[model samples]
Target: MAQNDTFNALLLQEGDPRPIAEVSTLNPADLPAGEVLVAVEHSGLNYKDAMILNGLGRLVREYPHVPGIDLAGTVTESSDARYRPGDHVLLTGWHVGERYWGGFAEYARVHGDWLTPMPDTLDARGAMIVGTAGFTAMLAIEALEHGEITPGTGEILVTGASGGVGNLAIALLAALGYRVVAATGRPENARHLEALGARSIVPRGELAERPDRPLLSERWAGVIDSVGGDTLAHALAETQARGVVAACGLAGGAGLTTTVIPFLLRGIRLQGIDSVQYPATDRERVWQRIGDLLPTEVLERCLAKEVGLSQLPQRAEALLAGQIRGRVLVTPTDH
Candidate 1:
């Protein structure tokens, strides 16, 4: 009976143009079996979420899917003793939006193991603002630090510097005292990225194109690379000896056309960053650090737009077109 209760959701249906999303009421029973049921307060749009929404990546294997990769909300019920009603939680990665029913709805039933108890300083809205993008950025930052890349090592290069991950990385690195060089295709967003704490801006074209040689003059001591493909190759070629490059996304392209010169000669460390399946203890640690490093005001600035379930389709299209910037928060209840 309780499972029959209906709530509004952004349902994605298989269709001609691709996965088509529209607002619809869903039953709690329709949700995949999991240990916790969340009364989702907010979800954030990520590039991967956009791909699922637009059916670009076939990320959702089934029809009538709910596509939201990141959500912050309050737990309404829990089968696992670790959580309970009234507990605030955040969920990102773990192939949620892709392989499981996700947070594009007012309610989400998810594995208790996939949930992170929200930090004391972070509310549901604040957590969603940082979402998966900021969380990944934090992971990258940790990897860089773990690799012995300190703030004083040299300037840090953040490719795809205007996207959610890029902007968040810039803010986090800047807050930690690193000199960040934000590389972006949109020179127009230079001022915006600077406000997020980038020390300087480099045109993305400088990195997107494949370089002739396998290596270039060392220009960066560390890098948070979200663009991937040729951009990743270029970042590798230009990193200082022993530098760490945290590869997170494939927004530009997935192919990395580079030689072993950087790895062998320079001892460059190319660390692949994956927020999905990140250990729970580490997730909590990273989230707590995010709350400490990124102030409320800084997180607010990262928010580019807030929309309801009804508005997600348009925003998803814009995101896939590379027309939107920063993070887009989706409020299902607002719909």
Candidate 2:
């Protein structure tokens, strides 16, 4: 780590109106003190990453920051016994992009405990395509399974179907022999969702609009909802008896205007997904599951586009505005 050696990173500097992201050069020596240093190859853009990138939410506590919540690459240096130079690893959650120096750079240093060995079958780019969104999708499916909702039990409704989590959830659930119906705002992506194994598509507005009754006609056997607020409420009300809804994101809104009748009378359950603090053991298990479930074809279809660090700012704005589809991967070394 010489002072003369430089790497590229998307540095966020404080500005009057909003934080700005600029591609800048940096020294590895300037990276925060950590046991393992990774040569980041690919990182994914999520809603949280967009929030951090645009300075919309108070996600980044410090300026001159990097904001990629998920990354996969090779370890260049490690003092921990669990990892060593040349080891392929991936990191998600643990507040890397929010509070700590993150992965939107050519290099990242993090505690060894936060690093998970990359899946043997997936390359760096493929692993990052799955990213935090896909990881959370897997966790949500695991939660549904834990709740005893089997594939044959009933049809699963996936809200925000055109997004990363929703799309991955559809593909994974379909791979597991479940009947899935995708709910999305983009009708143009109906065929895409169908190709991912969705049996049907429902307009997002249908669910986003508040329902008149606390309980609606029972339709879904279960739901994997990424858009919270009214959509989540509608799903809860429409879920069949003993059904489970795995609630992960709040892309639509955070406020929930629903009653407990869905829970008390219908025996439905709403499980919250927290990928940030998932146990290391379970993290390994889920990552392995994602590796097994997500095939190369499915992964390729979910890719919206591959970008470099320099393109992150515009992509971040598009992501926040709901103008992008699927997953966007950032290649740190792109020229």
**Candidate 1 accuracy as TM-score:** 0.97
Q: How many clashing residue pairs appear in each of the predictions shown?
A: 0, 0
Tell me model 2's lDDT, rounded to 2 decimals. Answer: 0.90
Clashes of 1: 0
Candidate 2 residues lying further than 4 Å off, grouped into runs, are 1-3
lDDT of 1 by residue, 1-335 (tens): 28768999999888987876789988877888999999999999999988887778667888778889999999999989999899999999899989998888999999999999999889999899899999999999999999999988999999988889998999999999999999999899999999999989999888888889988999999999998999999899999999999999999888888899999999999999989889877788889999999889999989999999999888988987777889999899999
Candidate 2 residue lDDT tens string, 244-305:
99999999999999999999998998999999999988777788888888888899999998
Alpha-carbon RMSD, candidate 2: 0.9
